[model samples]
Target: MPQPPIVHTHRKPLVYALVWASLPAATLAQEAQPTVLDAIQVSAERGEPASESTSSYTAASSRTALKLALSHRETPQSVSVITRKQMDDFAQTDVNDVLEGTTGVTVESVETDRTYYTSRGFNIDNFQYDGVGLPAVYDNVQGDLDTAFYDRVEVLRGANGLMTGIGNPSATVNFIRKRPTVANRASVAVTGGSYDNRRIVGDVSGAVTASGKVRGRVVAGYQNRDSYLDRYNNEKQMFYGVVEADLTATTVLTLGHASQTSDTDSPLWGALPLFYSDGSPTHYQRSTSTSADWSYWDNVQHNSFAELSQQLGGGWQAKGSVLRLEKDSDSELFYQYGTPDRQTGEGLFAYPSQYELNTEQWVADAYATGPFSLVGRIHELVLGATWSRSETVDESRYGQGIGTALPPLEEWTGSYPKPTFDNGISGSDWTDKQTSTYAAVRWTLADPLTAITGVRLTWLDSEGVSYGLSKATRYNAVETPYAGLIYDLSHNHSVYASYTEIFKPQTEVDRDRNRLDPIDGVNYEVGLKSDYRAGRLKSTVAVFHTEQDNLAEAAGTFDNSVDSYYRGVDGLTSEGIELELAGEVSDRVQLFAGYTYVDIDTANGHTAKPSIPAHLAQLRATWRVPGTTGLALGSQVRWQSAIRQNQGTVSGGPNDGQPIVTRQSSYAVLDVMARYDFARNWRAQLNVNNVTDEKYIESLKKFGTSAQGFYGAPTNANVTVSWTY
Candidate 1:
């Protein structure tokens, strides 16, 4: 692939205007007289700087998006942070749970353990661990990392070209780990919930040396639960440990390890069929099971990491990190689908299969950041480089009785005999490698005005070998650019505009056995950000447009001589607006709210993306009792518009080659929570979700067919007790 020239000429006028407008502020600041204060008195009264966990619903500052310590209003992009306090209050345990409540994000489930996240009409493919990028693969199962070891999760919307080398222009999520604390602390908790769910967690941290230069922390958790579906249960275990040492006054070294494992019995592969053979809709009970009792799925993941940080002269700082990860999964499941007869319940078939996967990944990065004087103004700059590699192997076997008709639904029970895996087949072995060099600068053109500009140069290579066939692909020296301008209108308000680009390499081939060009994406965004009550409350209103081109699509019929042919097409375009508010509204009240509206279209407009709602809204609030010091109560409500199922044809069935478009109704769910601190170091809480128990479809066609219409969870409640010392 050839590199494209950097484009900045179009944004020069806007950048100039912001710089000119800030000159007055700069002049006033220089001419104003400073008031002298009593140094001794001020020093005695000043408190510690706020940490990330200070607020229940908002963070004081973040460094995930740009590797710069900045407040929400200081960064010219859409960013949302989910704090530990918020997660604890809601009893969120995993990455999926945390993202479900975030602004402009949506989660859809394809199976019992598989989920997909999306934002701005595109799939979110970028995930970072402590600012280091991780590979996102589609064919393998994701571990759905546990949140117990993380202090917070930060989401940056739009193209993150500088940090993530190549990906979709949707968003990037960064999980910030909890560091060892200087002071000793310990805590333990136990929880019991509906459907026989039980969980226990322990956390401890302290200084390992008498001088308090070495610190260590450990966290462990276990959970066992049974689902609403019949004969389905799961067990999960997590462990994390870390050590931090101050080799010198200005240098630090850290090492950490994390492990997670999950075992599930009778895992569901897909949902019940949505329609009957006669073209009429079918409704099944939410507790209906499509899995047999003998099937199971097991997954395990392990990660080890090391980091070093040093302070150089002239206020400069340098940091480096290395991480290795290993993951494995094995599953034997049944997928029952196809339209059934309305009266006699016939024509339903079962497909049983088994799969095994193993993956290993290594990633490393190093960066240096500091401030410099440019034209008598102080500006900040960061330069970094990253390298990563991943390898995956997969194997599978299918049952011989696949496609055989099952008994009538009326006489069927949840218990069914497990099928045999006879015809075995091995999938391809794949490897992916990436290297990138990136640089960013925060230029203070004048007081109250700043410009952020960066670019990443990337090289990617991939190879696959399957069943005696081998292929290799490469994308060399591709460039992705980013630019943003932020102007402060007042002490509490700011307006900003940004532009970013995305590059994604494709593996499709043309008629002549030549690979197609990579897909290109450009994103444009403008927004207003505000802060209230001294950074305790934050809000943002943003509008964005994204365009993608050079999407590989089938162009002509398959040729026996050279396989199938494809060509680049004018790709998808999306425009949307988002609104978000989070943090303390008053002394005793905290709130979080968000809304999104998106419109998407393609060049031909022949097919629409399924299961994407046009409108979404969420709100949650908590209030402490005025007289009762330890009592608090909260509630949450979520609403979304109708979704369309875009299944094109039945493909050799009763409704063969016929269009099958089904619309799922909109829905709203409600939840409530209460907490009481009975003693100084003891507390108890309860949470009731889906209070009304409304039955609705959570997703339609999450797996590219109406046969996978997943139902939402029913009403459930949980209670927790904790002790701290």
Candidate 2:
């Protein structure tokens, strides 16, 4: 499939503001009280019943990413937070490992550590690091940061261009980094697993100045997995550091950096077939390889960012952030596939390829807020603007080989995935600049009602240079609007609504290089939300609809250029319901649960996007006996509906005009964990994943699939221990 264009998420929302109206006094605020939901008792005017928590726009709301992480209750939107504690418990290295049990979130692998993320049944490739916007990429990718560098991970679902710049209304992911501590602290951990896996981690933090005006922290970690997939194996190294300084009593400065590199000797795309005659889904051996398989990846990524904050006196506050990042990947992978030579029972297939990609980015933003009451009542409105730029280039080559999928054992000849390296840069040079002007106010209206209304105007200008085909070509771009509203019922509950717009530019264009109008989309949402339990529990339920216009579907499989793909006659639309919950019961017991139901169709009522699972559900829990301080147990079960892969088409394959087959069957997996706190300074833990060893498709696979093919992981596990100082 042609990759989706990179999307900017920090841009302001427009157009949508003109289509929706703000309800009277709907902003909600949490109060100083207690209830079943606890910590989040706030008031609204939208007729929502009083609850223990709230999703309000009060000046005290929407703090740092850490605040969101600390919150266990419902906000007006669908959100999830992964804490440092959770990372420590699992000794998680990759983002996929860290979020496996989180509610409202799912992570799956296409190959090795390379992965994908989805929320509310939509592909959410965009992510924010410390509130800084990052462009979304279509390729299977990995974030450079390790769990040792993050204080927490925050997930915000639905239209978010108001805070981000550009993106699908799907959802946004933000990774909050840990800061230096004024107190000294240190810890270490080691891990071992089934695939001959081994890992070690070290962390240290403390004050650098006598008066505690300056402090710093550092983290280092490494992991090595020998693997169960014949020659597939890898080793990863991570380093992270953070520093904070108080220039004065009211001013402070903070900076942080993270770097990671992974070297892989093998990555299994697929195994050899046991019996082509059987044609059953289950046909593979544990220790299978077509040839003496080998793969390599020299991956490197680094990120550095600084933030400044100063109290302006009064009830006002101000903050700003600047960040820079760089990423480079060089790799080679080969495998085998195809029918065997009848008598030899050996197939003649091979795939060999090599490529490199380099990307770097710089982004900055600033915002201010204070008191304003021009609408009706008093409100603390926030005003802000952001700018970001990223440059990426790809170089590749192809050879006759089996495929990136199957292994290349003794039976294969002819390599197909030959690297196109000699062909030069066949892609392009890209850049985008955007600015937004937005204001949000919180109206403290009648008794239990409050409202928050915000509007933003954003302008975008993008240019790209395609350097292949013997000639140099370039293209330029243009802007759009955004608005949102929330109604509070009382100190505990509320209902909210939001309308946002998204604008994206495509690299594929007409023969003349004339850039087409930016593809546009509008999203609408109305829902109920609440949270409580003094930082322990939260729940949110909502209904939403999204419509995109001027979108171009497949002009034909290979002709994905703008000139070739016509505007989709029906467009794309989606409507759905979602519920999420999380919390801790009595410190020793904790749980997270969520469910999503979605309906999507072409503007003309055809099929939905192939990647997303229509229904997703997960429940996880951890518990320990109150009196015993050493032992604990954990379990998580997840369920997802079959994936929707293809639609009727004439130019493609055998089923021309017939609905393309391959529906990933609905499947479930269960994982368990056991922990022992041998002493105050030491602990041990073990995790069992996919306990049932069920075989099912976990990805929206295509490549050479006939009908329904491909399968998820069979099963895996890891064990670890820690020591504190």
Q: Evaluate all candidate structures by whole-model CA lDDT and list the values in order.
A: 0.77, 0.59
Per residue, candidate 2 scores C-alpha lDDT tens digits across 279-388 of 22224444444323445766788888898876675545577889888888777655444433323454434555565777787888787765533333455556676777
| Best candidate (score: lDDT) | 1
lDDT of 1 by residue, 475-542 (tens): 67677777889999999999999987767776556656566767787889999999999888999999
How many clashing pairs does model 1 include? 0
TM-score of each: 0.89, 0.80
Q: Which pairs, if any, clash in model 1?
A: none
| Superposition error at 532 for model 1 (Å) | 0.5
lDDT score, candidate 2: 0.59
Instruction: Quote model 2's TM-score.
Output: 0.80
lDDT of 1 at 261: 93
How does model 1 fare in lDDT?
Answer: 0.77
Candidate 2 regions off by >4 Å? 1-75, 90-92, 104-108, 143-145, 268-282, 286-292, 335-349, 373-377, 399-427, 466-481, 508-517, 551-569, 647-660, 701-710
